[model samples]
Target: MANPRNPNRLPSSSSSSSSSSRSVASPPLSSPPRITTSSRAAPPPPLPSAATPPLPPRLRPPRAAPPLPGLRGLRLRAPGGASLHRTARVFPSPSSYEFEIKEKGSHLLRLHFYPFVARGYDLSSASFHVSASGFTLLANFTTADPVLKEFVLWIDSDKLVLSFVPAQASSFAFVNAIEVVSAPKDLIGDVAIVPNQLEKFNGVSRQALETLYRINVGGPKVTPFNDTLWRTWVPDNELFVESDSTSKTLSFSGRIAYQKYGASREVAPDNVYSTARVVDGSDSNHNMTWVFPVSSGYKYLIRLHFCDIASLALNQLYFNIYVNGNSGYGDFDLSDAAGHVLASPYYIDFVADADNSGKVIVTIGPSKLSSPSWIHGLLNGVEVMKMNNSIGSLDGDASVVLVTENPVKRGFGEFVRSILCGFAFMSLLGIVFMLVMRLRAESGRTVLWSPLPTDVSGGKWGQGFPVASGKLEL
Candidate 1:
């Protein structure tokens, strides 16, 4: 190819020029190095919007550990280095689970199960000893030998918690433990018995004679038959005549006697020898009445004894006794009557209503007599006794005696009556005083005639006449 040489090329001739021109031939400068720029600075990168804040640096969270496997076996360690394992396996059953613990050390270790069964579990059959220090639990199961496949044990606060896994055989398999804590010392010390000091001589059987000797010759003074006064007397006397087989009418100082003469011995006697007497041959049917004044609210005892000396063939005898007017009667056989009989001078006890003011009367009659000719009678001793509620009858025949011993004046009704009487008396005196004053006022007299006013201005008649008024002439 032919090349155009520049004047600066100088010599070297056409041949060198021709070769150099071929090598130097190139395209012109390529349009001033072809300057290029990014498109509008990428539009200012679209200026971050308020809707989306830049995300924080990514953080990795901690991973959780795997759960522990379920418990399969249970065991306990004792202080003596002995270990006890549950030998009998407990299988989940329709009702309960059964298991056994092999005997371990001498010192019992307390095993507590929880979620305490509220009710309906037969804890009585379950063999376990719970002490103040601890407790042990045994499972009751149906299967001969089943394994306890799973269980959990941990201390939740003060309580020991245990939970069991459900068996595939049953939907509701439960295992529980009991919690045992030490008993308070205060509770342990409170268990003690206190004895009474005044209980001596309470059950002693008093002698019949001694009891009779204590009877009052006059009527009842205090509580009719107080404990110290008459209860012993009546019972002792009852013992005396209970075995007596005499056919003669036996009489004691008081109006107490057995009627041996009549076909049926009645307590109603034809004669009573006390100072206060009912006229002889009065109505025999009338209950022999006696009055022992007592405080209105005081309690008393009234006793009655019946004696009969006729025949023993009479099987049944009945008596009606009244206490404060209440009819209390019972029928008895010869033997029973004998049992009620007082020894020589014993007193039986009976109670009087504290509100009763009248005397107690005892009437004896045959409820059912085997023979009409059998002599049934009444032997007598009645006593009123005093006692507190706590000390009651000591023996079968011995009865508790409670007497009202307050004085007569203390009665509320009597007190009110006295006050009313005083007021009435005072009122009567006031009326009398008023009547006397009225009578005196009526008797005193004042002259009805009025004196003519003495002629202050005297009528004048010469020397003797008083002076008359200025215009008057005599």
Candidate 2:
């Protein structure tokens, strides 16, 4: 769908009053900045009195209709402290928000939705589909409260377009705010380790990802303001199962060594790497585990952050990492992983599938290769991002057919294979038919005389021949 023509608009999402409501202008064409805009509109001015003197045609104002009820803007706040949920812009038909891209890389797209009574329309009753850059981000999506949707897209084009289409003509579409920010170039890479597979999984940067969970192990919640990318990281106290009584939280007060080849500050804040959840050395046989609920039948990109702050010497701690009972990393030597430097940040990425129970369990247990007195395992932070299904959708099981390959290329390959198979089948049939015809002609070449030319005139051996009567004529 294209941008709506003369679409009805709402109040400004950034302001507190409707008087200042206006559409957010596009950023300059110099370079894409880490900022965004929203859709808004200003209410029409009141009509002048008849007693006033007649003014020029150009000076006279156009007639304005009375504003609809419930069109007034309402103030609200999201859990992340974003004030963009105060107002929204409603579209009676299909519409879009377009952006010009100056640099081509991965960009963060965040959408805020706050359903309410807008004018005479019930925003909660509205069902719509949202798509961006030819990927279906949402399908038949609706909500009662404020909701935020975030996605990371790989854009190698000059423009990024977002379209919103209502499910029905009677229904409407709306948005409170939209954010488009350039993410770090190294935020996402092209490769990951997959469980049970000997080969590495590549092309991870090509797929669109939806943020599922971001957790700071053994630490307090880190809000968006504290993160480099305005991301939120919640604590893992509730996620950690207390039944495993052999685990505890560990904190470091020293500076983290940020190596040139290791994780950077943009990858994770220092607060996340400073604290960790580690297994107590008392119970060497037990493991520290954290369970998370996820949608079944979908794969997730799991990133585990590690900083060896618990160990005092190099090559002292050896542990194993497991995902859903499968070995993700066996005999993981933290000291060796961080290049024999304690407090250096290092992370690992894995592609894991959600089981039937809709649970992804991560366990860190002591490795048999380590001494019994060594600390078993430790983790600093964890991030889980959901990968788009084969149908190219992040929401529901709705299949959206995407044109990823050129039709001409696929058709030519298929045509060549078909022609080769046809020739092979015809050649075999012709050989069998020729062999059958030759055998028939060879059998008919030989002939046998039915009755022997024996003498029957009684001059020679006429008695040896039998007559047509029952008795022989001897």
Candidate 3:
């Protein structure tokens, strides 16, 4: 008989008990639907379409062995949840897993590493390097908390091999579970727009991407069970910068309308579009902003999901979007973009460069084009994924050189600021030049003017212009 499942008793870093050998207790009550273990390699079973409910992930056990020949397979049981996380395989030496490819195309490779203490071993200290086919996924990776590394890689051959090597001979490697599922055919688009530059980024499907953040804006957390892609989406309470008083969360009761040539459920579940965070029309001082810390200097693929759940009619809501303070979309209209449909799902992809401060900021504000009565902003979801650098590495091994034809266009506010700065600099120069001329006149020496324009007059440059303005507002 299976014991009752306890969702609250989650796994932790340190376990209370230990044994000389690996402990293989009874499987958890909520085990995965199926676990395929065979002497031969097998490809993961195909999942249902996005319209159907998501089932438990089909995982193929990795071939692992301990250092000692006679030791039992190193496995530990988790107290609750799926069997995949309940038991983990520890590797004392280098190990590899070969999976047969059923469909040769882009596939999602997910590696789960949950740190725990069992059998007198601390899994958190295990340092390792992971590689898929030829691309290096992780190197010298060790973590105190559980982490799920997701990669979208192209599988051209019939077999896809994943190698796990320890950092050193004395060190070890371990993994809780592995998932290699067939990704959507159109998951990675061919081109992504550079937000501020407004240029097309071609060949985006060729590079590998690592999932950094999947945020459900203004909604509760959406776990894998409710998601069509078996992906987890976290709430935006901590990520969003606006307070509850300034912005409010809303949930829609109607069905989320998915249209052709638009974002489908495969891209993101309906749960994401059914709820939104909308700014208060009265609060004109602030915009709805979310910040995500990431590796500096790497280019990221930012996917912003939108739905008009807050509006009662078409063309009633409009807003502006910004990425890292750069203008992504100026006065974006939800109804017009979605073919005059309400509650329709829409998404935009932007290839943006992460700031040196190691953060990506997304902001949405009420647009001036909208009616005064409907002045507000809203968002549904946001997904930030890291694109592999030039050297084909996700984890900062080689510096990613930013290549762009058109530089970011400065805003009107910035142009105004620049003009003011130039005026200030010229005024200071004119004062210094006058002082020098005065001293030369007292000494009875010739004061020759330079070839550059030295006259700060009001003739052609603007009549009686004040160098120091009264008030310069942004």
Candidate 4:
């Protein structure tokens, strides 16, 4: 449904009591910061003592926000790390905050919610609808602690509207903060990827560019203040089930990394190259893997970050990559891939269409290609992004091709007469054996398709240690 926001319904301005609450002149702006203003009026004072001279309108500052608890000392802080715990504009009734963005392109909108007692807020009654520019960002959502979600928006105009509406009477709706950041253009198109239809729907576009996880594998969290582009890179420990049991993921000593995805300069912090996740005693039969929890059926663009900081010689380390049992990249030797270079940034991007399990199993194992050199697989960073295709592609809606194209059956006679006959027979057996191994892995493995064990009815907040409950229950 379209946004039903009526500015006339905004909460009335509250009285000012403190010196900081006093307003200054609405700074001389060529134009207002917000194109749309609230439609509420300030409360009137007792007939403004007839004995007093009327004050000039320009001299009077705008009415200050009503005094409320949990609001003091909580000013908006710079956004970079896991969103801060304070800075809020609480809503007792329907409320809205509007902003104007001059840049027109794909933009990422971040909403922060912290259900604390800072503003006499009823944490249990925090159900509400959140919308941006008349589009739904969150609906009837409730949480126990601080939570943040990011969305990719394609803004065509400068005017933007963000609003909150309580779901039930007396239920207060509030926001800790909001942010709008520039995103890569063409990353999201207006075309919708309708299933069963092979083409873009009506030539319109769609984007599934919401960020699910951006992590600095094996490293500490990097806040926007320390990052190159004010981006937040969380540590992988928070989300992955790692095979390594060590107290720390293996460490590396590589140089700086420079990366560019689309038009933006997405640089990995220098610290990003200092650490990596490397499992010991890994082999070709079973590779070390990390399982991430995700929603199923949606398409994802999984990007891997690498920097040979270990100073390994040429072909010193070789590994194979897998995504949900499929070969993401086989026999990937980082140094060889980089032309035997070191201390430089290298990355690979793959698009995966999730299946019913909703989980993506990523494995990095020692490959025969590097077995002669003797080393293990290691990773520096990772990003799993949702895709927004203008064509009829929604991740799972994508089809996989397993058929192999080969020379015509002039081969049928060649198989019996050529020198490759013995070798070809062994190759066939190898394929069969690999198939058996894959089947065994599938049968032995469990994937999560449901909520975590700590998932409560109204919130997914942490409780005790989160244990994997086998595979998702569909």
Candidate 5:
């Protein structure tokens, strides 16, 4: 009530002196003007703390395994009962023809003619049959029906070659020109048959008119079929010859005393030694036997040709095998005696035991201590087959029979102990048939609670004991 008017009246003193003169002209406000906030220099210290990481070095141990190459397991045998399933064909003609021969009847063929034609024809009047659609050759003309113009035939499995070229004019010539023929005494040999209507005929040459007839029948021959079965061992002073048509080369020698693996040192020729040479006919005696041809159940592979001559330090020789004559080293002791050395040339494989035994004996030496020791050996060829099957006889004589041994694989703790004894005999017969059906359902629930206490007499629990306990609980 006394306010408004009174205050208004007081402030009117020049508005109270201009509100105390604007608070003394606000001049002493230094403290309020000191508001200077420009101090944020704390971000330059994050580049000096990085050096603590060095730990990863511990895992080194595993390196030592290299020494296994010494004819680990050897076996070799194959020479000449002859049919391990033989097959060889090379022909330009030295005369040999075999269309089929798994063993027929008579076999004796030998020819080594190489003079390049001096005039020789009559290869047995030429006629060999084998039917089944193979091996056929026929040529025999006198004159009247002469018209076979040009001819060149070749065969191999035995061998055959024929060459003839005629036809230029025609009249009738060629008299006693039989070159050579032999087969049951068909013997013929003259050489020079030219007359098919002569234009410029003599005996080869019109630039030699493409003529090359060579025939080389059957091999491995030296009287009496050369009695094959391969046998040759050189050491007894050496001097060999099974049959060498002069310089065909089949020589062998013997001399020993150069063992270093067993001490008695003297080494230099490049240091490493083992030598053997005898392809088929050398006789000295370190051991060599061959007669190969087995079928009864075919499976064969035998090879050996250990030759080490410019690096001698020998001491690792042990090989002894014999098939057919039996004795494949029984009670263990293939006899290494104390030798097992090798530097090269070693091939071995064997499988043949179903009774087609013909022959195979080999004995490489130098083991009983191997020193200056003395062991000479040679056997350059052996190969009995019947492996890939398919040649001919299981009953007729071509080849088909193999099963020599290598079948026994069942060990993982005997296949987990036969599946844990067949799952413990079927889980012990399913726990004895569930304990005999829980003791026959607890003896039929104790005979339905003792016949429901005698049918509760009357009604309460009776009625034949609730229909005989609900038909014995179903």
Candidate 6:
């Protein structure tokens, strides 16, 4: 019924004459059902191509790890979710395959292993060892539990050799995935290493340097997305050796430390700050040491990164830092020295000359005071920068201190070492030592590297590639 107040309403057509006309024009309600359906129903829709519903954007499996990028390995099932699943790689043999990277610099090496056992493999038989360019990255590594590893290495030559040796008991070893990202030339400082000129304190000229190692003292390897420079700072666990009980800790307390130095989450974007290594308070004499091998006669720069995440006073944690047994920093305190918890980080840098032994030793221990220091030894990050005295400094965000002191006096021992290195080892002893040095040589196995020209345009972020998981694994 139309409302009487509505002016737009149509006039009622219920007249005897109109009713008669409608009855004549329209069929009775009892007409056949088929005819009525044909008159009023819509056309059916076209059949669908697929049976199941489409996956949601997030649920869809991502593109699998870029076709080998040059290494050869079977693909494993990564159960860390589709994100990590697609990035998984597996090298079935106990021995490893080495890849050739044409360019050399400080590169971030990321190795991922999701501990989930696949169909045929037993997790218990998964122990193995890994090394890159003669430096052991992980030894006695196991998949008994899931783990993610990241490392920074200097690629000196045109090629990098990556080797994996599974334990005798374990039939095979594998890596779920790997990433080799190029890092900034100067890991800690913006300046470059240049040779000494006339004005320097000592007659010794600075040696050309490169980054042999960069470690995230207490943290996991940060991914490209989380890091502004996409730098990979390896966890110190592999190199960390406890002396009188030193321990590595991950502190939620220091999570926001980078912000204090005016860094936004995007810049200091990873969970690395919360992790740290500290000396054991219970031990009377605790120390933390890491050793690195290098070519003889080169000067190096070592940087120690620090941030106090513990809930103690500034002076509570105090220690001394040493390089090759020489005291570099006498008294180092984190909390007392660094007022902010998650603010920017603090670093101690030193220039060191590698002795004829071709090795550099870095150590941290309790202070020399007769009474024990308030806290314990601690470290957050470490960078071994190679100095290029000839080139001077470039732009990095680290501070470096050069010690132009008298070179450590060496006698006849130096002469003997130089001569001995040139001569070949005795046949029997050389073979024995070679086997003992598991990571020193590469076997006949060669990496496919790339059949075609290489493509590194992916840069730090893996541009043009959809391996979002790789970026997230920083």
TM-score of every prediction relative to native: 0.23, 0.68, 0.68, 0.54, 0.19, 0.39
For every candidate, C-alpha RMSD to the true structure in Å: 51.3, 15.2, 19.1, 29.5, 48.4, 33.8
The reply for model 4, stretches above 4 Å from the true place, is 1-87, 92-95, 118-120, 133-135, 168-172, 184-206, 238-248, 257-267, 279-285, 314-317, 336-340, 353-355, 386-474
Model 6: per-residue Cα lDDT over 284-309, one tens digit each: 47678877666554467776766666
Instruction: Write candidate 4's Cα lDDT for 1-474 as tens digits.
Output: 111110011111211211111221111112122223221235434323453222222221233223322221223232333323433444545545554555676666666565556434455457666656435555566877556566666667875566566655545566654555544443343443232234433322234355677777787765443432234677776555644333237565433444343211233555566677764433335455666667665666666777766545666777778777677777787876665666556766666666567776666766765553355677877766665443322233221110011112324545656757788888999999999999999977755564555545566556754756555554
lDDT of 3 by residue, 291-328 (tens): 88888867989999999987778888888899999999
> Each candidate's lDDT (Cα)?
0.25, 0.68, 0.67, 0.51, 0.23, 0.47
> Model 2, residue 166: what's the lDDT?
67
Q: How big is the positional error of residue 308 in model 1, measured in Å on the Cα after superposition?
A: 4.9
Backbone clash count, each prediction separately:
46, 0, 1, 12, 48, 33
**Per-residue lDDT of model 2, residues 283-365, tens digit only:** 78888888878888778888999998898788888999998889889999888888889999999999889967997888888
lDDT of 1 by residue, 98-176 (tens): 1111211111112222111223332112222111111112222122221111111111233222222222222223322
> Residue 89 lDDT in model 3?
64
Could you tell me the TM-score of candidate 2? 0.68
In model 2, the number of clashes is 0
Name the lDDT value of residue 84 in candidate 6: 42
Question: Regarding lDDT, does 1 or 3 come out ahead?
Answer: 3
lDDT for residue 107 in candidate 5, whole number 0-100: 19
Alpha-carbon runs more than 4 Å astray in model 6: 1-209, 259-270, 339-344, 368-374, 389-474
Cα deviation at 422, candidate 6, in Å, is 28
